[model samples]
Target: AQTVTQSQPEMSVQEAETVTLSCTYDTSENNYYLFWYKQPPSRQMILVIRQEAYKQQNATENRFSVNFQKAAKSFSLKISDSQLGDTAMYFCAFMKHAGNNNDMRFGAGTRLTVKP
Candidate 1:
């Protein structure tokens, strides 16, 4: 079994600034995937970035990047040049890379407010 945790329930960032959302996970499996998903007001879960356990390099998507620490089991999301559209409920998720089980564990979520 795997579990994801988001310590901060809410956060605010100024427009054109940067914000980092923290996430931690616990799992016994050696192979897995870590993800940061952004769900806007419309409630659509959009993938911000993803990281594989075996990959040492962190994943990045434009202004969105991840600080993945495999040893500490930490996968945090960094949003640069925050925009109004970035305001949403961000969720940290985990999934096993192998096996027939396709269950994904999600964090409680962190609601980010990008203020202009």
Candidate 2:
């Protein structure tokens, strides 16, 4: 069974600062996908970033980036220039590759607050 772990339960960041959230996982599958999802107070999940196990290069999206360590089964997210809008519950997810199909399992989540 694959499980995602986000050690940090909560975090706070000042506006325009940067924050990094840690995530680790346990999986036996060699090929899979990692994702960081942000669920705002409204409860909509947004894909912050994604990384494939085969890709050594980390993924970045504007203000978000990830450090994906396949060997260690760790995937961490960094949010730069954090703003009030960045405040949300961040969930790390894992998806197994199934012949062009995929299903996701998420961590407990790290609730981030951006203090204005």
Error of 1 at 55 (Å): 0.3
Q: What would the C-alpha RMSD of candidate 2 be, to one decimal place? A: 1.0
C-alpha lDDT of residue 61 in model 1: 95
lDDT by residue (7-97, candidate 2, tens digit) is 9999999999999999999989988899999999999999889998999999999999999888888999999999999999999999998
Model 2, stretches more than 4 Å misplaced?
none
Give the worst 10-residue stretch by lDDT in candidate 1: 95-104
Cα lDDT tens digits, model 1, 5-88, are 999999999999999999999999889999999999999899889998999999989999999998899999999999999999
Give the TM-score of each candidate: 0.96, 0.96
Q: Give me the runs in candidate 1 sitting further than 4 Å from their true place.
A: none
Model 2 steric clash pairs: none
Candidate 2: count of backbone clashes, pairs at least 3 residues apart or interchain: 0
